[model samples]
Target: MGKLTRILSTAALSAAIASVSLTAAADGTTNWRMATPWSGGPWLERDAQSFATHVRELSNGSINIEVFPGGTLGSALKVTDSVKSGVAQVSHNYINYDYGKDQTTALLAGHSSGLTPEEFMLWMYKGGGAELYEQYRLDKFGVVAFPCSILGTEIFLHSNKPVRTLEDFKGLRLRTSGAWAEIASRLGASTVVLAGSEIYSALERGVIDAAEWGSPEMNRPTGFQDVAKYVVLPGIHQSGGVLECQINKKVWDGLNPQQQTVLRDAAKLSVFDSWLSSSYADLKAYEELKNGKNEIVRLDPSFIKAVYEETTKWEDEYAGKNEWFKRVLDSQRTFKKDMQSWPEYRLQIGVSEL
Candidate 1:
């Protein structure tokens, strides 16, 4: 009705629009501190860094993740507690590291007794493994978990002395952990559990005769080849291992749906990047090691058969006692059995009859 009234109304509308725009721009902006157990390795640290970068990019800088390598926030083995206590908003760690807290973690982290890495990833992504993992985290530690890294078969063992047969493991002091430690003990090798950071020094100082850290790509950066001359193949003890990013439940719940989706997608991307990088690096590393002084040893077929037999027995014994272990193990085994026909059929159809 009046010139002054019209001018005031336009100004008020502009102020309201500016306020909404600012709020929308600032929404879901989060800075999360991420910790990892890997201190010096190439793959682990690189994977964590790339995952952080992916999250920030995917969220359009709304989420910023800062990663701290192993021992900076705390011991890698204690990363679970670090996330739970809110010392860190997130952590990259192997689930089996917390097996002492919940034995079922071994099944989720690294139990090679049953499935290969590809099979395990399939079960985790397509089958019900992801839900089970999330439930395990919520039920046991009050945290949220994502499978951030999945490694192919690792080096079974890197030894100072050649181990050609099952009996060669006798009296050998080996550095390993989880159910594999139990299996090593059963095989008459004295098992010593050491942190990844300590493996090189332990082997160099002759404190341990052998160790099994990861793939050639992972282990090469750690200088295991310098200390141990024998690189064993077919990492049966840790067939397909997974590293997960654990986030505080409260922090995870505080995120909006879009932020949560970015986090999950970023983790999945890290898994792909890590597997591809490590696979390529491992092939190159194998070539280097083969050309160099270190000897690559494939365990004798008889010895491998014996190890498998012992591993099966160990699984049977544990399944009888632990419900969670039995449940996860059975799930994997069933999946493996059901999928076996596909590979067999493919091989049959692809072969020429000539």
Candidate 2:
């Protein structure tokens, strides 16, 4: 073949390859969706909107994702199935909502053993909890789970009456959820599981005398204070709550490596931001509630200790019955115990809290 002809043929081959690559990139970019369990609510709204915006921008407008708020696409509980069955490409839902499918999920919702928000975040992100969570999600649920947000510990009792002692909980109709309901029921509170939206009316009509929702920031909007005058401090049941964002396994596998990396990075960043921001929000809400003349009270240390002991026992019993929960909890406990002394050692050396 002539040299000129050979050069032209090579150029044509290169052009064809470039065209195929461009087509593949375009196709991959336009094919993704994320559903969130936040329906115009501030917490989920802000993060979900941020994620959708980042997804589009990072992909250079090549990738497009639509965020379907809770109930807009489906109920929060339906999200897992929606993703699994390919009805949705992705979703953000509470792990506890799926506890029926796997008890380990609810167990991970809050540490019955009392890991603070800071402790839980560190354990999940830096201390090996992520790997365990991934195993549970992938092996059991057929989903790619990411710990995207932590709404601080479920703070103390908000009620129309005071809970001065453990005995005060007896026969009290408390609105609660997840494994806490089981624990609370055992403690003699008539636990009623109600959605956040329903709490206001229930509290108003005296359907439920008390309810433990999210942190002050999360609960403030629910108008719980409007009906219940007493706000309890120092959350016990949920020292911290982990919210997960999951993508369908098949959908996740279908993405290009670059897309996968983008998602993973965004999710990790979101968690860090969410945790820090939530702390600030909660602190602000606590100040506002107290200043607004709301009756605020902290449980006595004695009561706190008693509740913690009972909660830990519940955790051990439940963990024993479920091997997966047992593994995750044992791993978390071991990791935390190994690192527990570091904070004290640093403190003794005159290390600054900052």
Tens digit per residue, CA lDDT, model 2, 1-354 = 699999999899757533433133435556455666677675567666566666677777776667777775556667887778665677777888887777788656774567777777788878888778877988888889877777687667789888767788789999987777887887788999887789899989999889888788888888888898899877887887677778878767877999887877776777777877878887888788889857887877787787777777877887878889889878877876877787765554334665
Give the per-residue lDDT digits (tens) of candidate 1, residues 215-244.
Answer: 877777788999899988878787886788
- Positional deviation of 334 in candidate 2, in angstroms? 0.8
Model 1, residue 48: what's the lDDT? 83
Superposed by TM-score, candidate 1 places the C-alpha of residue 215 at a distance from the truth, in angstroms, of 0.7
Give per-residue lDDT, candidate 1, residue 236.
78
Query: Considering summed lDDT, which 10 consecutive residues are worst modelled in model 2?
Result: 17-26
CA-lDDT, candidates in order? 0.81, 0.76
Q: Note the residue pairs that clash in candidate 2.
A: 153-239
